[model samples]
Every structure is written in structure tokens, then in C-alpha cells.
Target: MSGSQALKADALDFAGDTATYALSLFVIGASLRTRALASLIKGASLAAIAIAVLGMTVLRVMNGAPPEAATMGVVGFLALSANVASVLILLRWRDGDSNVRSVWLCSRNDAIGNVGVIVAGGVVALTGTAWPDLLVAALLAGLFLKSASAITLQALRELNTTGASHATPVESSS
Candidate 1:
């Protein structure tokens, strides 16, 4: 991937995460069903991001060019630091319901992806090629997809449980 393309993809990632986190905040105080719905939305958003990154990476591979290694390394480090802070903040709530878990997953995945990008930057710097960037992008896309799948599944289960509980008849005593 080219330097500019990587930067653009990273920016989109940040924007998507920010929007999803904001959505979570809005639904935090709602019912379990609502929070599960928020998680569903977040999962869909993450899947979309994964698809978008995959597409971009494939195109970058087809038309290969070297990324700016120094820039990539610096930006990746900055993103990594931000993700670390987010992960730490969300860690306490990692075991929460689907909505909170989605937030934690997003932050955790981004932190891992940032490390991949930093490694890619170092590889590109040493090799003077774009393959490392492409590989990192592809791997990050995979990570996003995996996280999305998990969040989606958990949300569906929670929703199903909520629905099942509602469907059960309550017993009464005389």
C-alpha cells in the first residue's frame, strides 16, 4: 500500500471506531435489547470496515508502491498509544454485556493492528517495498472480521436470551 492510502485507511478506521463508541454511549442506559441492538450495529460497522480495508489492500497489491516507512512508523506508534489508552479504560468493563464487550474488542483489535502496522513500517523501511504494508492491512482486516464475528454472535445470543425470557410465562402463587 502507498503511504497515503494506508493513512486514509487508518483515518477511516479511527472514524468508524469513534462513531461506534459514540453510538454505544447513546445506548448504554437503555434496555438489554437496546444495548444488544447497539452491539449489532457496531458489529456490522466493523465488518464493513474489514471489507473496505481488504478491498484497499488488494488494490494496493495489484498496483504496488512503496509506503513512507518513517511516516508509517510514526503514525502507527501514535495510533498504538491511543489504542492502549482506550484499551486500559475499557478493560474494567470487558466482561460487561455485548455493548461494552464490543467496545473493548474494538479497542483491543485496534491496538493489535497498530502493532502490525508498526512492524510493517519497520519491514518496509528495511526492504523498501510495499508488501509489508499490504500484508499488515490484510491481517488487520482479518482481525476486524474476527472481532466482528464474535461480537455479532454474542449480541445475537443476548438478544435471543432476552426474547426467550419475555416469552416465558410467569408463575403465580395463591
Candidate 2:
């Protein structure tokens, strides 16, 4: 809602998260392979979100936009608190399936990103520059990339294992 570049990027991140969680919910109870597929989708979505944030940061840098530091801090705090709650709720389901794991990972990454935003807000306030906000946005993007890669790898492994087990016929006992 805020026109500040950082806040806008943060909003986009939240929107992406909402979509990711919704997808995860739909696939939570699916088969192992299906869950793995969902995880892959989530990973791709995370990567897309990161790329989008980075792109927005670059554009803001080019345009020399300075976000309102106080607003950034306030929003960051609120977002962090919300993400912490989401993470706590998803923590138990983290090891359940690929879909659930992806949900947990997304929530965890969001919390960390929110902290970065808060720090960026403080730095921006002190320096009166947009660099801190851009830096934080980039860092958050990197975090998203890291989590996406990890989730995707795990999902691929699960898919392979699940597929192989199904394909291999069990030996009959004498």
C-alpha cells in the first residue's frame, strides 16, 4: 500500500507468500509425488518472488527513491510479528511432507526478511539514503533464492525416491 520502494517490495513478497501458502494448503494431503510436485511449484514461486524483489530494488536504485524510514520500520515490525506467528504455526508440520515443508520454509524466510527490513529502516533513518533499503531488499532476495534452491532439491529427491519405490516390485516371501 505504501508507495515507498521497500514497502512495495515487501508487499509483493507478502502477496507471493499468500499464494504460496494457498497452494501448499491444497496439496498438503496429496500423495508423496504430488506433494513433491507442489514443493517444486513453491520453490519456483519463491525464486520468482526473489527475482521480482531484486528487480524492484534495482529500479528504485535507478530512480533514487527514498522510502519513509519510520514507515518502513513500523511495517517491518508488524510483518515480522505476523511471520513469526505463521512460522510457529507451521513448525510442527515442517517435516511432514514436501508441501508442508515448503510452507514452513516460506514462513521462516519471511521472518528473517522482516528483520532485515527493520535493520534497513534504522540504517536508512540514520543515513537519509535509500541504499540501506535496497541492500536489505537484495539480501532478502538472496535468502529467498537460497531457500528455494534447498526446497527444490529436497522435493526432487523425494519425487525420485517415491517414484523409484513405486516402480520397483516388492519380492514375494517363500
Candidate 3:
């Protein structure tokens, strides 16, 4: 309810992260190929979100008011704090296969995105314009797209190397 497009974008990123974790759970007992496929799906989903956020940013730029700066600042700081904690916790496992690495990337993204949100909030507070908010949102979308591309490329590489032996492996432990 802050009217901040930046915060809205961050919220979407958090939602995407949650979904990624859910997908991770589904592949916990699966093999490399299955995990890679899950990562690919997650990456594709993130790409879709980025495109949608960009479209939203464009519309907001055309006709949007400044958000509540105070609210944005407070929430952004809180988000950043939480994300940083997650980042620290996930740092050790950041370098792994596509699926495992995607987890760390998504967690890292929240902290980086929050910094932008906080900066946008301060700029909006000073200028009383939504331009900063919209800009940050768009930039976050670009970040999302970049992360998605990384995940997708790594996943494709893993799939290629693993061959077509288990393209559609069942995830059941038994």
C-alpha cells in the first residue's frame, strides 16, 4: 500500500524466490538432469516475471504518482536486513550446479534489489516524483532477466552434458 513500484517489484522477486524454493523441494531426491530441468523451469518463470515488471514499469512511468517514501524506506530496510541474513546463510552453497546455484542467486537478488528500493525511496522523497521508483523497478527487472539467463544457460549446459538418458526422470524417492 506504499504506492511504490519498487517495493512491488521487490515483492514479486520474493514471490519468485518462494516458488524457486518450492521447486527445489520437489527435486530434492532427484538426479542432476531432473534438478537441471527444474532450474530451467524456474529461470523461464523468472524471465516471464521480468517482462511483466518491465511492462508495469513503462505504464507507471507514463502515469504514476510518487509513493509514500517513509513507508518505502522502512520496508526496504527491513527487507534488506532479512535478505542479507539469508545471503549469509546461503553463501557457502552458492557455487554448485545450476539448480543449487540458482537458490543462492535468488537469495542474493533480494538483498541487491532492496538496496535499489531504498535508494529509490530516498530519491522519491527528495524529488516527490515516481521517476526514481520506476527506474529502480525497471532495473530490478533487468536484474531478474540477467539472473534468469544465467540459470537457463547453466541448465542447458548441464542437460547437454548429461545427454538424453533421463530427460524426464520421475522425482519420487522410490
Q: Over the full model, what C-alpha lDDT does candidate 1 score relative to the true structure?
A: 0.85
lDDT of each: 0.85, 0.82, 0.92
Better of 1 and 2 by lDDT: 1
Q: Write the per-residue lDDT of candidate 3 for residues 57-150, one digit (tens) a residue.
A: 8888878889999999999999999999999998998988888899999999899999999999999999999999999999999999999999
Instruction: List, residue by residue over 1-174, the lDDT tens digit for candidate 2.
Output: 433655666676788789888887787678889889988988998899889888888888887766788888899899999999999988898886677877788888778878887888888889988888888888888888998898999999999999898896889998
lDDT tens readout by residue for model 1, 73-172: 8888999999999999899999999999998988888788778878888998899888888888887788889989999999999999999989968789
lDDT accuracy of residue 112 in candidate 2: 84
> Which is the better candidate, 2 or 3, if ranked by TM-score?
3
TM-score of each: 0.92, 0.89, 0.92
User: Candidate 2 — which residues are off by over 4 angstroms?
Assistant: 1-3, 168-174
Candidate number that wins on lDDT, 1 or 3: 3
What is the Å distance of residue 171 in model 1 from its true position?
A: 10
Residue 6's lDDT within candidate 1 is: 55
